[model samples]
Target chain A: MGKRVGIEVSIAIADAVKLARADVIAAYPITPQTHIVEHLSEIVANGELDAEFITVESEHAAMSCCCGSSAAGARTYTATSSQGLALMSEILYHPGPMRLPIVMTVANRALAAPISIWNDHQDIMAQRDIGWIQTFAENGQEAVDLTLHAFRVAEDRKVSLPMIVNIDGFTLSHVIEPIVIPDQEEVDAYLPAFKPRVRLDVKKPVTMGPVGIPEVYTEAKMAHNEAIKASKRVILQGWKEFAEIFGREYNPVETYRSEDAEVLLVTMGSISETAMSAVDAMRDKGASVGLVRIRLWRPFPGPEFRKAAGKASVLAVIDRCLPPGAVCGPVGAELRSLFYKMPGAPKIFSFVAGLGGRDVTVERFEEIVDKARAYAKKRPTELYEVIGVREI
Target chain B: MAQIDAIVGWKDLPFGCHVYEPGSTAKFRTGDWRSQRPVLDKEKCIKCGMCWVFCPDMCYSQTEEGYFEANMEYCKGCGICAHECPKDAITMVPEED
Candidate 1:
């Protein structure tokens, strides 16, 4: 393993992009996510990384510039948080259908109405169906590793899809952790220089993102769908190679001590670490408890997730983001769909917790496991419950 | 107007629907939408090329006699050519004429 050093997660991600040798980075400043671009701008200014740093006006322009740069055969990158991501969402859909392999680091934050600058999955959840290959990082190490993994899978000739690495804002982004920054030669050995299959060259003069008429729109969309689905093979392949190179492993649906557990805690992002500790505590007390964290969000690892959670009788699914007036939280809803009508399927108990930088402590996770076990015997009144919401 | 020749299955479609063929735009003959056509009078034309320059769709092309004529295949009957004619040499005639 490489020498580990204590560094801020956001800064570590910036360093990861630098190691990827991205050709272009265009971004706007937003909270939690600002540190990443700030560090990157300095890297560009200091000439440590030979890359174009475009200080764009808005997140919209940041993404549009990414599309343009990627189309022109530049290895493009960008980063943003909640409102910034919401603003750039229209252009966000373009890169997917346009097949631009631009990588972005999203510092997941709560969306505003009452206004908040804190950590949550709501920001990324809003863009769930945008057709980008999305991944959630459980810690700073995963954040750094996933950033590099994103560039590799996204730029792969078979994939060529945009990717978003989601790190919970403030919770994961602001914290300083001991991270092993990979060597330049190691990164080079793992990820080769970008070879764009198609590019905007005057000699070629090919049209890109052209107006797809009704006759061709469905076909075009179908092709994009197939391409994204096929990308999973390459995604896994990249991760396998990454594990071989770095001696660190990653999976779509990662499990911890879930072999014979009756109750499983399902979580994503930084909260998974806390959930793990909770599971350990429960196991010490002789309770059957385990943890399953979702690493890949888009092109969701259905088979892997099903296999991991199949043995458990009850699932205490935790969602950091709550979509109002839904049957359950997004992750809850997805899990329901996964196990729906399956024989001997686990009973899912959805819990909404840790919204807008709220702490999802070990005690809260223990409570979820107990509640999931209690509720599995009988259906709860409400489909999903919001934990720690004091009605005052 | 003919639709894009995209009747093939999803697998046959290009990645991201990127049109790699050169001059692919030439396939869409937009002139079918033209309700009125530009009728040019060779006698009054001074060969000033105003119609060609003023054409929004690049529909006007100069003939061997130096008279600018609207290519009906791509012309959208915008009437800019007739309106911009310095000598009033062009008239917007309905397609029936």
Candidate 2:
């Protein structure tokens, strides 16, 4: 059993990492992600956690340092958001193919040309294809649990791939909530010490990240693709172990009140909580609406999503990042393509909302559900609809 | 191509980006890229070791008698050693096909 205490989500995540007994933490301060590394630094400095906290010059350097440490057989972690994630983008691709189990926290925030430091999914969404196992946390507890889960899954020998846990920027990162702080014994029982399959050592040297010439480049990429897709088993195993120890169940795709509903609102990150309330309210008034929150984003969890969403007659996928000039937002576009050929798949209506720190309220979700229901009936040819757009 | 096939056939080579053995590139003979090769004039050589320090490919190795010679197996024949040799004891010559 674990003790429940009220703590800021970022602080809880830092504590979770400390409990996980990370060997190295390298990060640069970025809005919304600053508090996480700051807390971790204090934890290391105070001797509560015996770890190396590297204050890197930039997010690029932070990820580079993480790569070096993780390659040297250390359990490594880092946190970044928005431009920091974009800055680290160059090195992000290296960890996946190098097969280093680096755990990172992306306090999801909107990207910038104008530059606003508020909450959105744009930061993490832009990094979808980087080969990291991405998991979205709906709230503070999920933030802590998923952070620990990420380390467990990443370090699994079968997986040995990097992972990112996305917590919606100020919305979740800055919020204080009651969360279970698992006992060190329970955590130790759940997560074993990282045993690296390959590492950089002076005594037994090995090359990592070698240039793949034309002859083997395609084969290398194909192997990487297979590794990530195959990691789904290890991911589920991690979750199963976590549930056994903590008694808190988690799934790749979680649902609320969707068993018999004909209409479904699909969401990721913090907005799913708001969507849940909207579903409750609509159900009270005799509306057949439900909520599907995608927890695992990478390796896509396609089969789980198909099973969860197959029964619904109409599905409204609310995307937080606008995939500019595309027919739909990123999540919407993915869902559309996923279901395009599947027999008995629901009609997926794409909706873009809550971008750039905009609040997605229950009423807005209600409106989105109504719009999706209407669109299902009319069957419009448009790619997707941008919700809450101001009419001139 | 045969050498590449042999290296690629190594058990650990198939595991994507992993390098199972250290210094595996030593087996990859980059000397094949050479259009020009460096020849050492043992009689004129002063054994200053400047060529050893200046070779871009680190292909220059010391003989048992302390004279430096280019290990043509891995040398790309960049001529850096010949260019930097103070005694003009090393010369760059075109390789015969």
Candidate 3:
């Protein structure tokens, strides 16, 4: 173990990135995500980290370079935010299905069209179906811890899926916090050198990036799906190992005060901390409210949710991004489907709030509980509702 | 089933053969082979040597008449020499196989 340091979460994440010792990094600069790569660039330039950092023109090229590096059997890392992430949308689907575990950091930001550069869930929401294992950090400490664990989990043999460790744009990315910095030897021992089962090598000729016909395309997709679905165990195992060394625990979905609560709020990314504070305040007032923070979003913790939602009365689902024309937000839709097998499950209500970095206060969360309670009285549960926005 | 040279209808299509078999060697066959064919305009032949110098793959050679000719065997159909010709001497045209 090395000395502890007081640093910003973004810097701490950069330090962890150094410890991982990636062979290649292809990235473009975007706000909030800039500090992470900037620090990494300094490390590489100052000779602290030995790696090839290719500064590409756009996010598309950044992802394209990562695809090339991973195909060449090198451990790769890249960081981007908001628009940069959107630019790489085309190549996002290739890595996971191809089973190349390139780790990435997505400083969560709102999507454009009044063109806001602030934090929100819109960027990641757009890529929900891209097949990457998604995870969110509640604060800077989790941000650093998750960044290191993400590489281990993604590279696990069962889950060769690319991972996106999302921290809030500005909130967690820019905030400084105390963190334990492990020595390089400790990290090397923890994360062994990655040996890709299949890589592009001239010594052994292999065909890659080939176009597949419809006859075998579905099978390839199914294999990718099964690999990610099986990755849950690998993810837990990696966390267990990390816990042994650092004493930090992780799960797909982490529950806070949900053991005896009547109402539960489910969310992802940095909003969980805000939601947790609200839960604590509400609990003090004798309101039986709790939170289900989804740290892993891609292979969503379905079985765990079924266990956590055991007997809660009303489940208030919150989403930062709107899935237009759908009954509820994305997380809400996924959670509702998990309880379809139960005969008597709690009534579920959806809320779309905190978009474009808008403030989601404790009062707003309490109001959502009230709405869920009211909606439960009526037998027919309307699927989703936008929380703060009012109709004219 | 009877073997046929060419199919005029769906009835002659092969059945039960998987297209994505491990050793499937099916290649895209086209009748109009020359999706791009280089043409030389004799009137505009200045022979500046720009096209030959700019070709990354050196697929062009000089004809006895001092004009450039494209070697189809080595040309990967990049169209760079034709597009970069200073005299507009090279033109691409489609040809039938």
CAPRI quality band, candidate 3: incorrect
User: What are the per-model DockQ values?
Assistant: 0.55, 0.34, 0.04
Candidate 3 Cα errors over 4 Å, as ranges: A379-382, A390-392, B1-97
| Global lDDT of each candidate | 0.91, 0.90, 0.80
Cα distance off (Å), candidate 1, residue B42: 13
Residue A212, model 1: lDDT of 77
Q: State each model's TM-score restricted to chain B.
A: 0.82, 0.81, 0.56
List clash counts for every candidate, in order.
0, 0, 0
Using lDDT as the measure, which candidate wins? 1
Q: Which candidate tops DockQ?
A: 1
> Which residue pairs clash in candidate 3?
none
Cα lDDT of model 1 by residue, A136-175, tens digit: 9989999999999999999999899999999989888999
For model 2, the superposed segments whose C-alpha errors exceed 4 Å read B1-3, B7-16, B29-55, B58-97
Give the per-residue lDDT digits (tens) of candidate 3, residues B1-97. 2122231222221211112234322232221233576777889879887778887656678989888876664454566777888888887766542
Error of 1 at A225 (Å): 1.2
